[model samples]
Target: MNTRPPAARQIVIGVVLLVVVAMIAFLGSLASMPHTDGWYAVAAKVDWSPPNSVFGPAWSILYFLIAVAGWMIWRNGWRENQPNAAQKTLTIYTVQLALNAIWTPIFFAGYPLIGEPAWWIALVVIIALILCVIWLAVSAWKWSKPASLLMIPYVLWLVFASSLNAGVIALN
Candidate 1:
């Protein structure tokens, strides 16, 4: 039996989730924005790297999709009597969200502030982030198909980004 709260309540929660995710992205951007012109401009990047102009808009869209996916799972995954599935689903969601949250500072501030090791460290974190994303989609599939499907573009973007990071490492 579906144990979801009323639609109105659920909608309110979703809107809140959306705003929260946006805030997380905004905070991350604060760490990242300064570096794009300073460190990133000179950093060795893949020849095919999208112009710096592309990241902000791309991330804005991705963050929206991620928020929606999280909301969908929250709506569909719970049963009042058996909350285990929902708890696990949200736990995975949180794990991925946390990984996403930490990636920006590690990448943008790593080299300039922490020395050469930060690049490799950031690469590790991004790779873990990619894996967590894939895992979230798979786990979310049991609760919400749309949530699962929503992660595809994110996965693709991350793959492209990981390759770009790898290239940066290779060149520099």
Candidate 2:
């Protein structure tokens, strides 16, 4: 007899999750020192590279979407009592987040300093990152269609990032 739809709780949790995701993304950006010291300025970029100004806003939007998608999945799983699927989906999501976090430092800082092995390592990481997002998209589709729809931009961005990463590897 108490079906109020729980919007308040969901909103709170979603906002909290958004902050957490933003923090994680901020830390990743910090670790990369992406803008402060002109690290990216020296990197060899292909003609298709977007302006440096685009990355910050693009990533901010993507991360917000990512958090919302995760929150949607979390809310559904909590309501439906599907702990196993939730766990798997969250695990994939976490892995992708971790991969996204490390990519900037690895590609921009580590690879350039260490030479060939580092470059190869960055490529491997990017490939793994791509795989993780793909998994996230598929798992989200199975768990929540809206969540899956939410992930499309992130997936597309990652695909573009993979090409950029590959280009960096080839050029530098």
Local distance difference test, per candidate? Answer: 0.85, 0.76
Model 1 misplaced regions, further than 4 Å: 80-84
Candidate 2 local Cα displacement, residue 20, angstroms: 2.1
Off by over 4 Å in 2: 1-9, 34-39, 80-85
lDDT per residue for candidate 1 within 46-75, as digits (tens), equals: 888999889889988999999999988988
lDDT of 2: 0.76
Q: Output the lDDT of residue 26, model 1.
A: 89
Provide the clash count, candidate 1.
Answer: 0
The 10-residue segment with the lowest total lDDT in model 2: 76-85
